[model samples]
Target: MRRTFLTSMALSMGLAAGVAQAQEKSLTLCWAAWDPANALTELSRDFTARTGIAMNFEFVPWTSFADRFLNELNSRGKLCDLMIGDSQWLGLAAENGHYVKLNDFFEKEGIDINDFLPATVYNYSTWPKGSPNYWALPAMGDALAWVYRKDWFARPELREAFRKEYGRELAPPRTWDELMEVAKFFTGREIDGKVRYGVAIYTERGSEGITMGVTSALYPWGFRYQDPEQPYRMEGFVNSPEAVEALEAYKALYECCTPPGHSDAYMVANLDAYKSGQVAMQMNWFAFFPGILKDEQVGEVSGFFVNPRQNEEASVLGGQGISVVSYSDKKDLALQYIKWFAQPEVQQKWWALGGYSAHRAVLEAPDFPESAPFAGDFLEAMSNVRDFWQEPEYAELLQAMQRRIHDYVVADKGTAKEALDKLIQDWTEIFEDAGKL
Candidate 1:
């Protein structure tokens, strides 16, 4: 009887220990459902193999990504141990305690922020813009970039026609004016017996699409969110002459160059249009470039370039940083994952696996530019990239820009000046309500 009791007790204890171990070894990472998420999943297998930590992923489509994950973070849910969140969410996540500050962990692990691209560090990791207060590690680096049909540009007949008309070589555009001319040249032309359009740009109104697209044009044309000297004072800056001209230029491009009924297009719609050979050029994030290069339809014929210069060179920043969820019980494991991920070898492997490594070791390698067709353009774009407001009230700021810009650019409801003036009014109200004005 004694032996039987001892055996039963041992069995129960063994099962409990096993369950505890299993729980400690598992982790969940959340991000938007996209190519990079898949790459991260593939790359994480090595992490699992090395540390014996199991990783699970929950990926939401981009349309609902911010809503779903922001809600998860706001509600203090433990569904995710790690989150690869958007750059614009850093301030909100840090302020709201959704992300665990990784500064001390980084220092303890000798993970230097200087080793990552400066733009990624600034946009993705830092909460106070240039401060050293880091709530995340820059995981993927991306920017708005242009891709065109190389074969179309190389056609001798088209080149001759473009040169005759525009008095310039038929190459990728070097400036905004040149870009518009090229876009116009291709807007209604017949290519390979099919009618093709000039460009597929962001026009989607519901989310951040139009804001991103409009800002690409706005940035090069010298748009500023507010007076840098007097913070949040957006009166002259947001509705300045340069900014109004940029807005007008974007609206004109949309009306004259885009495909029929492209008023509601964003990333996926642009990708589909490009793949279907409906557009000669497309503006999209560098995160999609890897898949674009491997695409069966237009891969071989595609070429990429940085956003053209206007008054200055600039591109809209895109990408996210990986953070440990502050509410997670598995913080130790999540931190371990960060340490492992920050290694030079791991970063190199990440790049090889189609994940954009912000690590300088990977980006500055001798052969890095030659590693991918778009790598050089990606580097250039990152160097001159700018991001949207990263304030805790970023959603309100973005929504206002979206409404104002979409109404002007897509719906043709007002003049550029009127649209921007209304935007400043909207943003001013938001800031005043937040006590920041």
Candidate 2:
């Protein structure tokens, strides 16, 4: 969902040294500049102090992270020694031989692989399963979940009104239909004398914001980006009859319920609106939840819930684990740092620093602060999360799907079927060209 993962054997980087490398090898790393990245950077500083390996981070803007990493890695440029790429980049990086295997390192450090959530570790670690090697340990686990203004929803009059209107009591929604109903319920509702919208969704096109935001909704309606018969191939699900039905439902939900200029919404936009008390419920990634506690204005009353789906099985695929580049000169040091970070104490530190933990035990830790408010809900949802594109051409395939979703949600250029059909054609062509069809 955000910038980008694994593999086997004792693969060693080319090395010739009679040289006393500086007390610490200065390794350059790149990752997104969001709160989680900040949290990890703090951990990296601790790493620097101990090993004198001197890790330096380059915080790239999400806007151009892909192009920037590509320009560097493709040219064998030295700008980045270790990079945290978007999830979609995993297959490409692995295929391109840009990552080092980590299984040996884990064993050498005496770190138990089972300590991590298999869902988070397996996909990000290995290129193809059954390989004894791995690429990256999942640096963080992420999923889509919603948080709401409990105070407003709990008001006696509002609950009665919702009960009358929907034939049920007001509680966090359990289905897409209920999501719409609740979003509509609070869209123009006044609370504490301020007008508020019901929900905030990301629609921006700069990167993959639109897709990242919509995939959670898309999966629940029996929407599949591709036919299962083929690998690395996508169908025109975005514009399919079912997908269209979902999109129509989405259009109605957003049109009737979101704040002004919401058509331009992105993660930060939604966060800003929710923080400002301009929306009653907002869906976002977990990393931003801690900020609510510090923002003060809307911090005191927000409650959390898992996103609802039409099917009882929740429909969402979250972001993935991070990896070290195989091409880096500092593989040994990078492995060392990841080992330190994998321990329970370090992961707990990551959570306290507002970093989303891909380590399940740390997230589910019983003593997790209630002060942060939404921590319990997030840990619970993390257990059931999924990730998309278990194929090699994952990035290009994802881009194609986003293009079709954009057409349905933004351009209004054609029916969801028409747009999705085109995407399927486009994706099929790519697969055919790659001999994956």
Candidate 3:
């Protein structure tokens, strides 16, 4: 009787241990709470089904996303097994050991970083800029692009009026000067019994909104962060005559074309303005393109285009890389997830589910251009993208630019040249402090 009772106890203990092990097979992926997050949640179900591992998510709003996740990473908290961190965070995360370096794991699993888009791999994974030291995988590919009201542009009266005024067909502008002309023509115009503004640009003062928006103009007007040969030297390149002109042009657009009371507008605000027929065009990231195309009110009328060219073609890069949190206990499980996600078929499905896939196999496929109305434009924008500072001091550098540019462009505090000059001073001090100078 004693032997039989001991046998039953041992069997019960084994069952309990099995249940605990099964529960431990789960992973939590953290990212911003947006349309792409919802798509990722759906796509992860396939990962769970294939590996018998449950997926968990802790998504935060965009406004608080960086602060929340950075705090978690800084504290070495085990909140997330995987993190889809912003591209700008790569330098800090890698240097601070917040993310696991996956070079060996990638090699063992036969995952080629080369299979991803070169721009994404360069921006999203490498810590030392163009080095091979990868700490993440490019999960979402994005760039700043324009979406205009095609239905409005196609109107005969408007077309003839625009042609007469600008000496060109009322089509998407291929140059910044032409874009300005188009904006001037559309501003204060009545469309469908409503007064419509020319554009909804990124003028939000509080965060990275305005910087991203203004950089689109700055890049085409030949702005560079530093002398390519001598890094951290910002005087000539950052505040050049061309860059000042670009800044002035951006300010002009904001003052003359944007909707009334749009002094502080960002992605959601711009989207709202465009959807309500308050604006003729909106500048936004391609990540939101899928949702915009599916929007009930403005979906059918919207047409996409790459950023207009000036002295050069360029667009602001926007996206995140997926990284394994070094603090997590489930490192092996997180690696498995990355391995599974790198598969071409899975990446194609990721795109289908509304998440931008950075894999070349998905992007370069013959059917890719026809996959969505905005796909071709997305490809074009990604090809000539530029990113802000990705050093460990990225936040400091970004904040400095934000203050200087916003004071000038929105508050009307200084001249374009003065703003850029002050920006150079701020950046020089930062780099000097970090001993990069």
Q: Residue 316's C-alpha lDDT in candidate 2?
A: 49
Candidate 1 clash pair list: none
Q: Write the per-residue lDDT of candidate 1 for residues 1-437, one digit (tens) a residue.
A: 99999999999999999989977799999999999889999999999999889999999988788889989999999999999999999889999899999889988889999999988999999988889999999999999999999999999999999989988899999888988999999998999899999999999988889999999999999999989999998888999999999999999999999999999988999999999999999999999999999999999999999999999999999998999999999999999999999999999999998999999999999999999999999899999999899999998989999999999999999799999999999999998898997
TM-score of each: 0.96, 0.87, 0.96
Question: How big is the positional error of residue 360 in model 1, measured in Å on the Cα after superposition?
Answer: 0.8
Any runs in candidate 1 off by more than 4 Å, and if so which?
1-20
Error of 1 at 309 (Å): 0.7
Q: Candidate 3: deviation at residue 159, Å? A: 0.7
Model 2 quality (TM-score): 0.87
Tens digit of per-residue lDDT, candidate 3, span 1-437: 99999999999999999989888999999999988999999999999999999999999987678789989999999999999999999999998999999999999999999999999999999988899999999999999999999999999999999989978899988888988988989999998788888989998777788999999999999899999999888889999999999999999999999999898888899999999999999999898889999999999999999999999999999999999999999999999999999999999999999999999999999999999999998888899999999998988998899899999999999799999999999999999999988
lDDT of 2 by residue, 1-437 (tens): 12210111112211223123543477787887787787788877877788778778888776677778866767766667677775556667777777666777778888776777776666666667436466777777777888888888889999999999989999888888998999998888888799889999877776777776776676677777656675444544445677767767776676789898888677788888888889988888877777766667877788887778685445344555666676677777777777778888888788778887777677556676463677766666666665666556766776776777777777677765676678778778777887877
State model 2's lDDT: 0.73
Against the reference, the lDDT scores of all candidates come to 0.93, 0.73, 0.93
What clash pairs does model 3 have?
none
